[model samples]
Target: MDAPAERLQAADAELQEIDERIAEIGRQNLDAVADAYKEFSAVLDRYEDRATDRDDFQGYIEFREQMAEVLGSIPDDLPHRDAFTEADDELTTGVTSVLKHANFDRARSQLEPAREYAELRSREQDVQGTYRDARSALQKEQSTLETERNELERLKRLGEADLDAPVSLLREPIEAYNDAVAEAFDSFTHAASARAVLDLVAETTAYPLVEYRPPPENLHEYVHESAVGEESLSRLLDLAGYSSSKLDHYVENPQAFRSNVATNQSYLSGLSATPLQVSWPPVASDALGWHMRERIAVVGRFATDEVVALARAVRDLGLRDDYERLRTSATARESLSETDRTRLRAGEIERDLTTHRASLDSVREILATYPPLGRR
Candidate 1:
């Protein structure tokens, strides 16, 4: 069990002890005796000041009558009957006797059993409240443990992949294709028109795995509509930095270039073939095949025959029988940390999973018993 479950068990034990003591007191009929003592004490408060030394002679008669009635009210089978009878006898020793506070103190001491019964019931209530608070604390801990258990299960699934399988078969072709395409696209972007590059990027919006940010609306319109669109992206950026009068000699409208091209220098300069490259730990065979098909179509428009041939090789990797096996192995090798591998080897993950499942079972069992009725 966890810390919260342990604390709840302790509180439940204490509450049971208090309940047993209270039940024992009830069986002795001391609760009835306590009611009698309350009545006897109230009578003393009303008549003691007036009756003492016969200060009010009529008050003395009334005091004796009330005390007699209180004593008569007690059942014969009640526990501590002698104590009440003796306390009453001391209060009525003489009609005109000097009644001191010492007599009252002695009478209360004689009725100790009745007082004890009242105190035990009060203690029972306090312990019951503590039991409820402990139950709520256990419930909160159970929720947090469930989330951690789910993450551990995911790690266990990932650890099952074959670590020694030849992932390099898939990695070699992807790396070669990624490098060839990047160098080829860089040459195309430097020498080609800004319009041609934007058109190529726009064709890839249909392919989800190709994560290219679409060109800004105003910038796309400026590149396709303005004569400045004919210049390479590198030359357009260079013209944007010149003074307005000097910029006029380079482009048809200098102010239009500032609003359209200069204002969007970051977007145009950051565009590249990086998005077309496949990732190191490749995706599933089916997904990579679809992504490669779209890449071949877009890169084929301007890239050399050699780069297009490399891309075709990557696309064909999905047709191999061992593709899925190699992909899963590659993912595990790249994703798992050194600590994760150590724990899996030592069987720590399975042990931890079992522990959390047992803790949840224990927490739920206790909650069902207590019901958390009076939660603190």
Candidate 2:
């Protein structure tokens, strides 16, 4: 009976110790679960705030797009448009900054919860859900903003059309004037006949009569000079008459109308010659119309065929001059003998061919004295 009692007491003591150890583990697990719950709640709050901010940001973006569309349709509403654009930019910056902070805060909160839960060996999927929610909210807001921005850009271009009608009206006469002027000067370089020059002058002046009131006085002088040669100034000459004096005048001063011609012709004789600079006139009117003012409207008209022929003639003359120069250079080069050529090839012809014969002779003598290495 004593042995049995002792055995029962030992069993009871062992059971109590096991129970105490189990209770301690349960307390530790509960504390760990409490900490994890706190972390999870913090992460959830952060994610919720981020979602709210993302929604707010998306609302601002939508508002911006609406404002842009309304303002873009009304060109008269530029001040409003600028305000909306600035507001949109501010909202975007604020939203982006808040979202970044929220993501970091949420991620940090979730990480702590994840670590606690991992230690507890439970609920990893719940923490992963929080991370996914944060990312999804961010992507949704970004996508909405991008789509709205694209729509706003389209509206902005549509707004530009309002200025088109008035601008087009203002530019038409200016363009015509520029084109007429360009044609006038371009024709002047190659005006083969007095009539051709006069036609160009007329076209440049917007087809004004040759004796039209308010004629280009400076141009009149050039034409008269071209028409009358060294003969006496005769107002008695009929308008239709072409005299020997007139022919002689053209022969003497083909470039008398230089100022009336294009500025580039000073460098080349032809209308079709490549200009040294391929620059356009500053105003389209300068290229199209000879006269900018409406009061002085009657401008010139030259024959296109005549202008082209003159251009060809000028080019032919230039080519002829080039050919002559080339011929002269070739003649000079060939005057040198084969010995001279050898010296030139060897870079021994320092002076002219006449002064370099000795060096050439030395080269020949060396070649004769020493047969090629292989032959020897």
Provide backbone clash counts, one per model: 0, 29
Residues 1-376, model 1: lDDT tens digits? 6666666677778777866775776644645765676777788777767657456777777878888888888887777788888888787676457676677777778777766765565565676666666776877877877887887786787789888999889999989998998899888888999888887777778776777888887888889999889888788889878889899898888888899889988888888888889887887778878989888888888899999999989988988999988888888898889998899889998899898888778777878876664552
Superposed Cα deviation of residue 35, candidate 2 (Å): 99
After superposition, candidate 2 runs with Cα above 4 Å error: 1-166, 192-297, 300-376
What tens digits encode model 2's per-residue C-alpha lDDT throughout 158-206? 3222322333233333344345445655554433453344443344334
Error of 1 at 127 (Å): 19
Best by lDDT: 1
In order, candidate lDDTs are: 0.80, 0.37
Q: Local error of candidate 2 at 229, Å?
A: 6.3
